[model samples]
Target: MDIKKHKIINRYYHKNCISCKSWLPATEESFYSVKKNKDGLHSYCKACVLKKAKESMLKNYDKQLERMRERNLLPGMKKAKKKYNSSLKKKKTQQIWQEKNKLKLKNYRLQRDAHKKHNITDVQWQKCKDYFNNKCAYCGLKIEDHKILFKGTYIQ
Candidate 1:
């Protein structure tokens, strides 16, 4: 073996993380072992790997969401939504989000179903329309002004 390669291998083989510059015990939890590598261990420790993964996820959050949405639209994906909804992770996330925006969601539903929901009377709904001069309550932007009403709009 070359002198430099031997030194480099020796440095990381003893449970040393190249990225963190710290020494930890050689264990499956602390280091990632690769069969192809001469030392059979990754240069960076598990903590560094996790930190990198989290950073990458945050940086590509929107792109990742778009990709997942596209993937769900592929063939044989009709049951994907049902499966996702049934998952405990999805249920827990939905519960957390709903809990955080209880008042906002309630107001939204009232405005949305003014004719159906008893909490929002027709008279009160009309008054609100009059108050806003028939403009969108949330955006206040005139619908007539925007020719494309439904296009390029996010519900919530």
Candidate 2:
């Protein structure tokens, strides 16, 4: 290989790491990038550079965490917060509407309870209704003919 193509290896040969004092091969892989340095290679070896970087990160861990917390409240992160707040507002509005419509809500609860007290779903209830041709299961009366009483309002 041409020595010019391997500038660091040719120039430094086998240099000792400043921090670890261990001999490392003079190559791009063994050194950190330093743009301003004459050979564009850091004085410290890659292992020392990484060790110092990790130590600095650990020392300022709390500051990093606080910065991340502040970042989460920034405009870029507002979409998820806005969605959560809007969903909560919608839930409150729905509750208020249900409270105002007592008769309608009562009918809704009766229909829900008709299938079973536990482990029942709207799909299963619809299946049951379809099986009986939308008629009362016990009385055999058409849903429009009979009024089933549950919570004051007669539910069809």
Candidate 3:
């Protein structure tokens, strides 16, 4: 708004904005800058120029979308959705960090499952169960005898 602050970035006598063309004489007070163009001069108020730029940018939405598609992504397919369906997504995504150890989820469960099929006699299981569950020394949860190392009696 100060009359003296309006110095042209480029030495082109910036008058008023072309859109509004607010004839801001060099001596008048204004905040808008005078942008020089190849055509000679660009008229239009600074406010209009900014508004036009925003509109121009908004119009490029489809162009931006196309650019994204050109870079490995298929048209209309969102990268977020693609990641969500991928195996890597589960581990690599922010939703749930994949274990640094990797595809080793449930390894212990699988081992225990296999062991259940091949080892442990009923009596041995009872003994083990009885031993493991003498009750948490402090919590006092009755330990129901569960299977120990599976392996029916063989060579002693």
TM-score of 2: 0.38
User: Can you give the lDDT of residue 123 in candidate 3?
Assistant: 89
Instruction: Give the least accurate 10-residue stretch of model 2, judged by summed lDDT.
Output: 147-156
**What TM-score would you give candidate 3 relative to the actual structure?**
0.26
lDDT of 1 by residue, 1-156 (tens): 233223333555346677887766565677898887666777678879867765665566566556756668433467887777778565598788779999998998888988675687788878877888876665454445222333334322
Model 1 clashing residue pairs (backbone): none
1 or 3: which has the higher TM-score?
Answer: 1
lDDT of 3 by residue, 1-156 (tens): 323323354564435454664655443243343456432333455456556765654456466446655564443457655755685655656335435534554676677888888677988866765775654333232333111111121122
Give the winner by TM-score: 2 or 3.
2
Over 1-156, each residue of candidate 2 has an lDDT whose tens digit, in order, gives: 234323354566665677887767766888877898666777799878866765664566567546755656433557767776688777798678877999999998899889665776889888989999996676454564433211122343
Which pairs clash inside model 2?
A: none
Report the Cα RMSD per candidate: 17.4, 25.9, 27.6
| Candidate lDDT values, in order | 0.64, 0.65, 0.48
lDDT of 1 at 76: 49
Candidate 3 overall lDDT versus native: 0.48
